[model samples]
Target: MSTPSRFKKDKEIIAEYESQVKEIRAQLVEQQKCLEQQTEMRVQLLQDLQDFFRKKSEIEMEYSRNLEKLAERFMAKTRSTKDHQQYKKDQNLLSPVNCWYLLLNQVRRESKDHATLSEIYLNNVIMRFMQISEDSTRMFKKSKEISFQLHEDLMKVLNELYTVMKTYHMYHAESISAESKLKEAEKQEEKQIGRSGDPVFHIRLEERHQRRSSVKKIEKMKEKRQAKYSENKLKSIKARNEYLLTLEATNASVFKYYIHDLSDLIDCCDLGYHASLNRALRTYLSAEYNLETSRHEGLDIIENAVDSLEPRSDKQRFMEMYPTAFCPPMKFEFQSHMGDEVCQVTAQQTVQAELMLRYQQLQSRLATLKIENEEVKKTTEATLQTIQDMVTIEDYDVSECFQHSRSTESVKSTVSETYLSKPSIAKRRANQQETEQFYFMKFREYLEGSNLITKLQAKHDLLQRTLGEGHRAEYMTTRPPNLPPKPQKHRKPRPRSQCSAKLFNGDLESFIKDSGQVIPLIVESCIRFINLYGLQHQGIFRVSGSQVEVNDIKNSFERGENPLADDQSNHDINSVAGVLKLYFRGLENPVFPKERFNDLISCIRIDNLYERALHIRKLLLTLPRSVLIVMRYLFAFLNHLSQYSDENMMDPYNLAICFGPTLMPVPDIQDQVSCQAHVNEIIKTIIIHHEAIFPDVKELDGPVYEKCMAGDDYCDSPYSEHGTLEEVDQDASTEPHTSEDV
Candidate 1:
């Protein structure tokens, strides 16, 4: 009851409580150690089992390989005694290979009347089934040795796995108990500490006057300590729960590895039995119950193991236990579970995917826009260049518009000065006169021999008559009227072939189809000519004409032979005629205009041949794109073909002879001389030196023809505006627009 006695008693009581707390802590520590040991053992057992199964699979593979080799040797020794091919064919009869299981199905139809068969036949049947028996027996014996060892190792691993799992659960439960007892001991310590009165609280029961306040303080202190103790207990409980969860997860993992390894071992056993068991064929054929039962038990064990390892909880219970641990619902599922945060998340994902797709489409469109912008820029540059070239050409004086400009004039003068200066001009003039006399003599003789003089005169008169009624009488005076023209010899033109050249006129298409080999051959020649000289020209020049012509020729030849067999030599001539028709049809301006037909014919009777040639050149140059392209390649084609005329196919003269009437469309000639003269003059001038007819860079550049000819408003617009060279005399009458005016 005294102060020292009470103090001593309190100390002793505190010591006893402390000892109990220490013992509880010691028990918890021991349980923790046991749990750790069990975890380590379980891990070791799973690892060992994995190694065992892997080794068993390897051994089974080796055993099967040995069996295969033995079967192969037995099959070789027991091959049928027949011809080599027949023996080779029958050798697979009982080949003891694993994949040959399907082949064994042939045995089902074997004769069951063995009782009626001779002794030799029955013996052969016995030999066929048991042919490889000894080798199989030896292989099976070796497999049995391996199987026994594998089975023992597998049993040992399973036993260890079971024992370790059992020990782990036991220690896990003990650890939970120890943790609870430790919590209780800590509570008891807190109660004792409250009774003993700590320095921090400073409450004493011995102060009688202040006893109520002291009691209240003591009660407060006790309550505070109890609350603090309860919190610490909660922390301990959480720690214990976490530890148990970790252990349970470890157990689940160990169980999975065990079942997987065990399943592999079972598979290996089944393979060995099928491949290397004693009497395996008999066992398989008979559907042996004992082996099947064993396999069924092993599969059942696997199923049970999987079920036991699966963590068990109803849907509601799982949600209560770990509400946030599950995977989020799919986007569609969120629709049914509407008004949840998941719907918002799903919407965000869908929006992100759509945004990504849109972003890719935008990138592709931007790339295409860049390409289109580049093409537009290039085309604009080309158009500007074409306009500038046109302005330069149009700057020439109207009187000499067809003539070369001052720059080209200076070049011609310089060349003339170099070769024929003032001093030598007289001497050169004398030599040119003599050469002219000789040329005229040769021309007169050639004209007399060919008998075309009268025909030329008649053709001239015919051209005059066809010139339109008002002009026909005015132009008829110069013609020689006495000559009678020969009767025309013409082939009935074939119907046009259905060709892909849709732009061609009917006359052009028909001529090309009739010409056959000649058209393709000329197309090849034209292609070669353009590739050499017309490289800078645009439009169809960019086309691979030579290749196209060759392909067309090859295709046409494949379909049938040329139709112009009776007139093979004339085929080339007809082809030239067809080409001319194509040139006329393609022109935006007709070569022989329907409106100005008489005016163009009047130019042929002009006094000076050079002036007349210039007038005709101007007329031809009035034709837009198609004429220029045709003139360039046609000149080259005729020039190229003229050299090969010795073969009797076609020359420039023959082409001119054939095409003049076709191109001009003059009336029937009364005088043969006039007809021949008109025909020869055109053929010699236009087809040979075509560049002389269309000499301007403005003519060659594409825009003038494309813009002026193809436009719908060509008639109302001037030549400068619409690209058609209309009313040259009217233009010359006005003050011509200089390049600056343009």
Candidate 2:
């Protein structure tokens, strides 16, 4: 049991120590393998990244160069071309071309920024990754070397312990064998003495001597064997002691390798590699972030430049640059050739008669062409109808042929039907052909007639212009007769006859007399109501009130009852305004009478502000006394209303547009469309220059003056703030009057 235990213990100790060492070596090998693999992966990845960045840098640089070249090419082209240069100079920075330049520049800048980003990746981020990979690989190699050295050392210690253990076991077995031999020798010697002493065993002297010798030899051998056994035992003890010490040292070394050395090597390998990789990744991310931020900033600048473009300003700039090109052409004047007639009557009559004759001839030609064109048009339409009928019959024949083909009729029958249809089809086609020819001829006739008519119309217009010029020339040469003033017979006012007789369409003078106020009752009511409430109403006069409400209010005014007198809330402000506008529009005679419309409109054409105002004033004073008083009163109210233009959006211009035609309608004989704008301008001028145009009613010796002298409400005239009555009278007396109305 002891021997077996000894052998088993020695084998177990060696086997355990070898197994631990092998496991440690295997773990170190695995770590080294892992570190190598990671290093290889990192290197490959970094190489790939560097290659990508290098290519990206190249692309970005090339792109930037291309953008720069493109911009330069266009810019050079523009600079070299005369028209482009002129346009650039004219429009300056506000032009679309300038905006395009800015856009191109921004694009170039963006390209450059991308190039910079690429450079950053190539020079900084990629390089950093390369450094990290290189550093990690180097670290991996160093760590692997150290691990191998540690494992080797541990293996050496384990091998030495194994050798020592084997030697000890061998020595122990030898000692046991030597000890067994010594015991056997002693036992054999004892047995021989017993045999010799036995009676049955006779021994001679020689035999006795040999036996003694044998015994002696046996003892001596025993002694010798005992000595060998002692020596072997001592050797085995020494070997065992050596083996234990080696085993202890080997275990301690292996434990230290696993707990300290291996851990340190693995940590060193992984920490540096991971840290490098982390830094490289962070740098890459930061580079991308910075590139995006720069790109966004560039895009913002480009967008703002694009948004700032204005084509209208460009056109205006061009106009400013080339003023002479946009200037009006020189006006044409009549020129007399050499040897022109000196006789006034005959020469003028001859020119007039020739123009009249030419005009009449062009007119007659135009009439004949128009009649011919109409006849041709009718003939063409009739011919087109005949062609349509022919086409319809052809379509029916074609469909009938198609039906005959689809049916199971015999080929002979089909052919016969086709033959039978062919003739009629030909006849129809011939008819269609003739009808088409007739239609085309009529169309040609119509076109010719239209062209002739256009030519004759142009001739007629030219002749008319010539005749107009001749007449104008004659009128310019002749002096206008100073006709005596026609007597204006005053008519007696008629009393109101019926309730339906509206006050709005009545004579202004009759209404003024009936109201007994310089400003009519309706006008005063509307103005007062608007000034009180509707002053802040948006689009005061531009927005119309309900027709029903306006009519009702108008009837109330005509019934001699003030619909807007009290409880103003019952009447819509717009309705009251409508009533006022309706009254002015329905006037038998406008405030600026029709007779004076031309004179009033002409005043607006005067260039000088002071003279235009004086002209307007003179013309306004020529109005009948009742009309002039109402005009002054109405204009004063309008001027006051315009003061609140900000709230009502009814400045003098807007008010003028609303009341221009109402107060001074264009005459029937005049081109109302052409003169409407002039009428509005005159009204705007009167409203704006009311202080300068119309005198204060208090200064006037008329119905308004009597009312003002009585200290009436109308006495607070719009122009009363200008000067005293004496000053106004002096200024008025100095002014010239064309009629006794003033």
Candidate 3:
């Protein structure tokens, strides 16, 4: 029996099998990997199912919340002016904490006692409860309304999504597809983890789809569905316009951003994304749920515009009059305390006046002293002839010393004066002359008539006098010196309806009740930034003129410049009145800063002030070029600025923004230099191919354009909106069916 008579049969061959352990181990490892793959697939499916069920639970919570609101009405009606505690009990049912507890408890019960720390069921339960919590967060504030029909509609969408998910696995002609993908992902994972052992830990995997045709069919099906959805969405938008407008207090921004971004509405008149969806839902809701689609929409734009002119139309009047409540924080008193304390420009003017007056006074006194000295000199001349032998007066050099002192005081002043002041005046005068000659482009709204201009000038002069005293920016000029200022019939200063400008002086009575009262410093800084970006346009969401109030006055000085600091006068008030020139003399293509802003555009052409101003004005008049330019410009500007700051090691304006995939979290000056060069080169190339787009914009002056391929290929989003050829190829590699709304 010694080892079965020492290897006789082929099956029992035991001539010291050479390392069959390694082969056996290899087979076991393969089997292990297969098991892991199946496990992962199951886990993924279960997770998806849980997410769907969680959504359903959320719908339940929403329905319950709505019921509570309905019950509140009933409770209020039934309380015959008595029984406070009972009424409180009814209200408690709606309390967010209680609602959340009930929702979670229901989930726990539904989970069949299988709840554990890592339990999928428990996680689902928790997710549903969290959604309910969001709804009940602040009773007075409305949560996202998930209506019954909407829930049903979302359920339908989930079913569709599941169908597509299932199709992915079945679509593969060969079962090896999922396996292949798993292998690929595992390979990537391995590369990342830096593991080189013979796969000691087998990863979970699933059957992979191997057929390319199956993938194409799935993609085609998805495209067909998406197209149908788009059509339905479009119909829904037109139908639900009224409904959307009605929810103005809530839906305005959402409606604009979500829809307009996805469509061409920014250029042509069209419906938004949600509106289209709502339209499709209209007939369905009306037919099935008896929902009135018309109930939600506010007055349409045309009606709103007409209503605005009607001062008595309580909505507009109430809003304008009560401005504080509409904004926020209701701290008018605090704002008043913070505003216009420095009034640098105004103060500087006062200082200039005082200095002038002092000089005049000194001149008069000096003249008198000279006359007295000369008279004394005449008499002394006769006396000096006799005293020449006695005194021997030495020659004096006082004049030279006085001149030297005067020149020294003005040394620092010269550079700023010559560069900033003289340049601005010469440039502005030229622009004014240009505007005077050209008439088609006058801001017709501001120019009523020549007579009005005269009156405006008179008012401006009076305004100047009021501002000149004590550096007070808040004070309106005392009523124009009425030389019976022949009021050739006052036409009312561009009725409050016309002027978009903010009140320079605080209308404390008006803004005291606003709910969104931002600090004056924040307001001022934002305004300055906006103004720096462009000044012709008023600020966004701003009620006050904090930025404008900060002028080239003595109080507004640089950090280490004591003389300027003590006085607060550095920037000239009118220096930046017109557009700044930006030239792009490069080789790429013409792109420029023009659109997507609600206000002043800073696009420039390196010459002519009014031309520059008019050019910028025309720029944002519409969404110019294409979405590509807009996306490119914004990305470049943000990335460049972010990188430039990083290189300098300065704190970022918004550090969280650096987390985006395309974001260079801490891009430095190197990125900036590279980006800048690329942009410049594009401009040059565009000039060469000037005939392509802006055929009229000749080679004499180049146009600004955003350049990607800068910053070491920032196109890493793996998706494409404004994309390069390489980026598009990468995007195509990701099957659209597998992608989410992101």
Would you estimate the TM-scores of all the predictions?
0.20, 0.33, 0.17
Better of 2 and 3 by TM-score: 2
**CA shift of 582, model 3, Å:** 16
lDDT of each: 0.36, 0.59, 0.29
Error of 2 at 433 (Å): 99
In terms of lDDT, model 2 sits at 0.59
RMSD of each: 47.6, 57.3, 43.9
Which window of 10 residues has the lowest lDDT sum in candidate 2?
A: 330-339
The candidates, ranked best first by lDDT, are: 2, 1, 3
Per-residue alpha-carbon lDDT of candidate 2 for residues 81-107, written as tens digits (9 for 90 to 100): 665667657654446766776676565
Please write out the lDDT profile of model 3 over residues 115-212, one tens digit for every residue: 11112222323332232232122111210111122223323432333333233223321223333444555555445344333353454333122233
TM-score of candidate 2 to 2 decimals: 0.33
Query: TM-score winner among the candidates?
Result: 2
Which of 1 and 3 is ahead in TM-score? 1
| Model 2 lDDT, residue 145, Cα | 59
